[model samples]
Target: MTTQEKRNLIKGLIFISPWIAGFLGFMLYPVVASFYYSLCEYNTLKPALFIGLWNYIDLLTDDIFWKSLWNTVYFALFALPLGQVVAIALAVLLNQRCVGRPIFRAIYFLPSLVPLVALAVIWLWIFNGEYGVLNHFLGWLRLKGPNWLGSTTWSKPALIIASLWTVGGAMIIYLASLQDVPRDLYESAELDGASGWHKFLYITLPLISPIIYFNVIIGVITTLQIFAVPYVMTGGGPARSTLFYTMYLYNNAFSFLRMGYASAMAWIMFVIILGATVIITRVSKSRVYYAGE
Candidate 1:
């Protein structure tokens, strides 16, 4: 309304103009164009031809698309919850006053720092059917190991097991949250004759619930979009049991040149992620505890 205010606003906008330009050029434009292209038949080799909602309709009837979706959902159902439990359990253990605590924490976390491709490659060898370390150990107890990557029955499970190796990042987050819980609360619980399990359920969990909710929401998004490991390790092989939604989308976009179909799939995935996040938030409303709330 005033000259000084207008001048300040212009200066602020000028300072942020680079960021504004980057957002429009790199982020907003691509999203808008992707949505438009999703409604059309697009391949890099030719001009896009508008085809309305045919892409979406085709996706609905596509068997492979449904299979990929099912695989992704199946992976998420098992991976997300199990990852959370393992991470929380590790965090709780590491939070205790014990010898070699720092070393143990680092040992647990180092796996997550490995590159995804490298991690996949390493696990590929580890899960090898014959002459593999895992099978060698299993044989010591007279138990036979399944052909992990080769068997359709074991491929998804193998990927899931490989996924658990990278739970270190989540573990660190939970460990931090655990450390932030007031020590006096645990002491008071102990004075009340509360067992370790009781304290964990009643005191520790409630205090760290907000962090759990945060991790669960993040885990949902990440697990649903899992691509790199399965892509490198299984290559969606052994009857497509390990085929995930993102891998299928990648194939459509790059491998098959079905960009329009891929775009439609991407948008659908976006909706799924958004819906899952909203559902999680709604469900957490009664459960997640916030300090001083």
Candidate 2:
């Protein structure tokens, strides 16, 4: 190679060296090691004994595994779309010029800045069954409130509702993308006698579709890995209504010391996320447009 080409190659490797090192040391090794572990029966004290596909087979018949998967799917199904809509709405509202807009945006984003554990604790207080703020307010209005964390029926919804409080981070991203949309498009639409909603439908939505796609992917991945809130607030209680996939994985790895089983579950999760992301990207290409493309 020429000296200039060698210099470019060296610079490229220098820039990527940290990522390459970290991936090998932290990610690649663990993933490969985990696959081997998944083929064995491992407990912390005992050496892993090769058990072939027994772990995978057992997972198929395991009630807890199925229940955890269902619960996670439920959480994601409800939380992802609901959170995205609310976040986008908040972003749209905040994008407008109004008095104290910055303050309002800050208020909306405040919940996201709170530590996860602290937010969970505060939500626990709000979701408390007997003397909780939510129930008390309902009582004053003479409306009956369902037992949220205490009942199987309401527990998942309560978790979903609590999660909505943190949609501000997503809203901020959407707002930033919304600002980049060309102002002349709206002006041109108005000159052509398009209604406000029509302009939004034709111009604004198309321009922001790329960000929307990104948020959907991010939201799915994050929601699938949900652990802390449900763990802290519900403990997978009320008959495991809130038991997420990650929670189950944690229990098997640490509480039950079934590291091999946990490794299998981790791989399963990775596969699910990867498949969903691929499907979404493929489907979105028709709608999502890049400016220069």
Candidate 3:
């Protein structure tokens, strides 16, 4: 290369050097180290002793690990679809030309901006068995409310309900996608005697299908790693019904000093998230619609 070209390349590299260094130190190193630790018996107090798949083998027999996995999956199954539907519905309502539209949108989205721990604390009071706002309201209607955070049967459902409170973030994304749908398509469909349901099913849905797919992929990843709220509220109580995967992983790493085991769990979760994302992408290949061919 010419001297001028070499100088230009060096200048360009200098401009991006910080990003390259950060990626190597903060991202790449941790990932590579985690994999190595996963294969060893490591605690923070002692050196990592190479164990060659023993941690992974132990996980196969760990009953609590299996329980945590099941709890996470159950929560995801209900939380993901319900959150998507509610967010999309809210987006659609907000998209309409109505008075106080901005006010309503702001109200709906404010909850997502609240800190996760603070949100959990607020919900803890709301879900209390007696004298709680929810149960008090149910009392007036002669309907009894269960101990939400205490009952194994209802704990997961309670978390699912709380999960909906943060749907505002997804709703904002859906609203953006909804606004981009061409107005002429809806007008043309109306001219063809298409009803509201028909227009939504045949036109609106097809146009926003890509956004829906994007939300689904994100929902899968986040729901699988859910931890904070359950940790704060129930502490995985009432027979470990709320012992999610990440919470259990945290306990192993910190509480039990099983860093190697926790690392293995983390890698397993990584694989599961990757597989789920791939499956969703494959499924959406034929369903998701882009604006242009």
Candidate 2 shows a clash count of 0
Q: What is the lDDT, from 0 to 100, of the residue 166 in candidate 2?
A: 90
Best by TM-score: 1
For 1-293, candidate 2 gives per-residue lDDT tens digits of: 99999999999999999999999999899889899999989986899999998899999999999999999999999999999999988998999999999999999999999988999999898988787899999999999788889999999999999999899989999999999999998999899999988987888889999999999999999999999988988889878888999999999999999999998898889999999899999999899988878
201-257, model 1: which lDDT tens digit per residue?
Answer: 999999999999999999999999999999999899989999999999999999999
RMSD of each: 0.9, 2.1, 1.1
- Pairs clashing in candidate 2? none
TM-score of each: 0.98, 0.93, 0.97
lDDT of the structure predicted as candidate 1 = 0.95
Clash pairs, model 3 backbone: none
Kindly list the per-residue Cα lDDT of model 3 for residues 1-293, writing each as its tens digit. 99999999999999999999999999999999999999999997999999999999999999999999999999999999999999999999999999999999999999999999999999999999876788888888999999888788999999999999999999999999999998999999889999998988999899999999999999999999999999999999889999999999999999999999999999999999999999999988999999888
Residue 102 lDDT, candidate 2, scale 0-100: 91
Error at 143, model 1, angstroms: 1.4
